[model samples]
Target: MITTIISQTANVRDVQVETIGDRTTIFRSRTWDRLKFEIEYAQQKGTTANSYLIQSDKVALIDPPGESFTKIFLEKLQQHFNLASLDYVIVGHINANRMATLSKILEIAPHIQVIASKPAIKSLKEVFGQYTSQFHTPNHDLDLGQGHRLQFISIPTPRWPDGLATYDNATSILYTDKFFGTHVCSDTLWDEDWKKLDHDRRYYFNCLHSNQTKQVETILEKFSTFKSKYYAPNHGPVIRYSLSRLIYDYRQWCQAQQTKTFSVALFYASAYGSTTILTNAIAQGLEAQGVHPLLINCELATPEEITQVMENVDGFLIGSPTLAGHAPVQIQTALGIILNTATKNKLAGVFGSYGWSGEALDLIEGKLRDANYRFGCNTFRVCFSPKEEDLVKAQQLGSDFAQNLQKSKKNRPLTLPTNNINNLSSDRTEKALNHIIGSLCVVSFKQGEMDKAILTKNISQASFIPPGIMIALTQEQKTELLPEIGTSFVVNILKEGRNLRRYFSPSSINTINSFNELETKRATNDCLIFDQALAYLECTVEQITELGNKWLIYAMVNHGELLANTGITAII
Candidate 1:
């Protein structure tokens, strides 16, 4: 149903209100044409700011959107109810962006008490100072009225430690502030045809929850205990019919991410949410390689957490936005943590968004490079905000870095085979092996949510009877690695001058938007098929053997197609 504007003020502000339940009404402030810049929203989809109004014996307001919707939101609220009648104003979380609108509400409703989680209470005082004395901090629940009671759940993630969700027992609806939300702006009040919204929903999850899998799992488990029938998230359509299915999907996705052995510590501080856009894009790329990303928003993260995560990760990436001419204090503190705690040779990356000068990016790059650290990709610097193309580039760069890390681990002397040159006297067999170069191809596979891939010059037809081919992957010394026998993979043949090999280079692995420049599609076997390649082969591993420094696997071809007849196969 289309939302008709309930109020339009002299300043040309638009606010639409619609009743969803017996006493619950939603005030939506829409921003439909603001998608050209970088943001937390997936695909830069436009968003609607949804604020709820609940009235019973006492009236309560839940989560006011930021200053952008402040004037219209307040105007619409005044038309429906008296300001003095507002008994409580509930804050789901605290951030600098929402302070302006929140302060405006407090000014008009002086007698209204502020309600929030324990952590949010502290932040309220820090931001609002003297005015916060009248706030009410709920331990677990609050009684709004006779039948309209509210229960609170503190769901803390690294990004929002003060996050709170409110449940109304009378209606079985949960006011999920940040959880299970998408940025898409729609006229529909409920998720009626949720199947059609799958892409946007999954994109939102990938951007926000993918890196916070462990925390997501804990929160999902908590949510499972509640008998919530409706999920009224802060943005997008309210979930009713598909709530159970969405929760199940979230659990499965988070489990796959948490089970990955490879991990990267992604440290970033977003001043205007620009840096956050880049961070999300990078994390998405890592996820595709079965590499878990531990994301920390430095502004909200503790020093202890930062130090611990950095020490445990296989690689670390830092991003900051330039304020004036240098990095923010929080980012500087994170940099110190990295220098003091992380290994010197650990793979590192630097990126930043800036308005004028990009000194922050240069500073991070110089510091890490001087310490003899290896960079997974070139330093990323974008002016104002990143565009759609920029986000894709960042993702590919992340994937390339992951592939390089896997290659480096395998090539290390610890994994060298018994027939390695060190074991064999510089013999003719070793020299002959170097001359016998196979076709250069990208082999990728996916099992559940875990994805694994490698760039190799070791693929050749093994037999015609079963239409089989063989691939020799460098052996990994560690037992935690992916690529087990019986796994399925796609072999993408590379054509000359395609430059796909640049992404797999160990010296400078390009992780961001690696696939953006390539023409690709998925095969029947679910492996990626590059349209620019000489040919593509989809196969499943039927047998495996250890062949000097590699795991040789023979696979029966499930599908094959030639993309270009003149496209010469790439050989190393």
Candidate 2:
């Protein structure tokens, strides 16, 4: 009976090539299981590889799914129109995986012209033998015949340097390949349930866009010039109702990263995609420490841009995959730029993967050493393939790098004031760990229409992209302020003081006056927040795990604002 139900749900007909608007059809490939292409999709739930067909007088297909769906995709595509009639295939980007499907498409439709950005065209010619004849790099408006006029825009990011999008004049639908997309599969074709997808959408941005905020801000600016009523992304749903909200949110997320007090720039290039994986783990580590690392793809970044980033960041890390006993040309160029551009006082770290000789890693380490730059950690290296443990270590390296950068900024050292000697020794470990676990903040919530707050130094940041934190709550705290998944709350970081801490002590929590007694204001999420705090993060609970004696809660941060620009986080 279970098998029968599963089979019924996996019906191919559930999501087929269907008309969504005038002259536009969506060839959505739905998967109930994981899409194992990239790290973002690999660990998460299922996703859709959305392909679109525009049936203008000159027919064009936009952003086909990867080779995984080649046979079935070809089969269904032939049912509607003749393969020979498909004139142009507008490819948003080129990857080895997607090239396989493009190969199959060429095998069936030999004369189909491929349209892409200049970078993508170069890749297409290099990958596909026959692509030289029909490849086109559109630098201006592209007429698809009749009313379906189109324009191509290049919005290159670190992860996808060849990213491109198309805008249809008649329908006002922007065919976005990677922009404004989420990694989730659905039977529906439209983004009608935009609220539930908020978390996933934010998570997707964190994974892909957070590090490339500079490029993303440029993309958003490009988007504003377009008169698009909806966005047809290559994953999840067609963004209609949520288009405006998402655009604004993307800007806000980018602004948050841009305005950070201490920033680290992470530069990387992966030969076989191994170093890329390590780079992501390291980025997660930085995020866990509440620092947003600026990611730069050496392959895509110009020398001037690289130099500018190195000059602005407080610290920077460089990672490169070895090729023929040396670093890739891009990395070598970046190394030269780094040596010339960055001051020796900044923190430096190097990491990468290699087949045999790791001279590339050695060269970077040696160069920085000669410059007298301080090393946060040893050079991280992975040979042939990286295991689970390597990723964990890479993440630790990132976390350590962030911690070191933060420590370097502090003018004063942390010294404990004299307390009861017996009590200090009893809980020294937990107390010491608490200081560095997360920010020292008072978490506030509303229970039964009354505002409540708790002094928590254990709210550890868990995910950076989706903006989330993990918190362990005592039984008393749990009962005082209920925390179920999806509930909204605010975590307010405190300024350096002793008065607020005394008010939220275990003995004083029960006897405190009304929340109104404190100088507070309402958050954007409608939760109470202390006006004098360093900053506040608006969060919605995502998961709950029960430990032996404590309840662990993971919540996604929706929005955050710095209340006092000069106020530092309280380290009580």
Best by lDDT: 2
lDDT of 1 at 228: 88
Model 1 alpha-carbon miss at residue 340, Å: 5.3
RMSD of each: 21.8, 24.4
TM-score of 1: 0.62
lDDT value for model 1: 0.73
Give the per-residue lDDT digits (tens) of candidate 2, residues 1-572: 00111222563422356677788888877666765645467445677788888988889999888877777777777777787788989989888778888898898889999998887888889878656989988867878887888888888877788899999998999988888888886666688989998899888887777778888999999999988898998888889898899998999989987887778888999887788878887887787687888889888887668867876777889998888877876786577556544665578999999999898898778767755579877899999768777888998999999999889878734524323422443232222211222357777887767667777776765654445778888766665665577788887767665356555753224223634566778887777878777667888888888788888888887776655523224654
- In model 1, the runs with Cα more than 4 Å from the true position are 1-14, 34-36, 39-45, 118-123, 269-278, 285-290, 298-308, 320-345, 353-367, 381-572
- The residue-level lDDT of candidate 2 at 44 comes to 56
Q: TM-score of each candidate?
A: 0.62, 0.68
Residue-level lDDT tens digits of model 1 in 1-572: 23464321232336668887658888877666453344355465567778888898888899998887888788878988787678888989877658888888888877888888787798788877777777878765667676778988888876677788888887888898888887877567789989988888887787778899888889888888889889988878889999999998899889878778778988999777688878888888888897898889887777678877875677889999998777876786577546545665468898879999888888778667654578888888788878889898888888887887777566544333323522343222221111112357777666465444557766655654445777665555111122565666777767666787665532222222555566567878766676766567778888878777767777887666556533334655
| lDDT of candidates 1 onward, in order | 0.73, 0.76
**Candidate 2, lDDT over the whole model:** 0.76
Name the candidate that leads on TM-score: 2
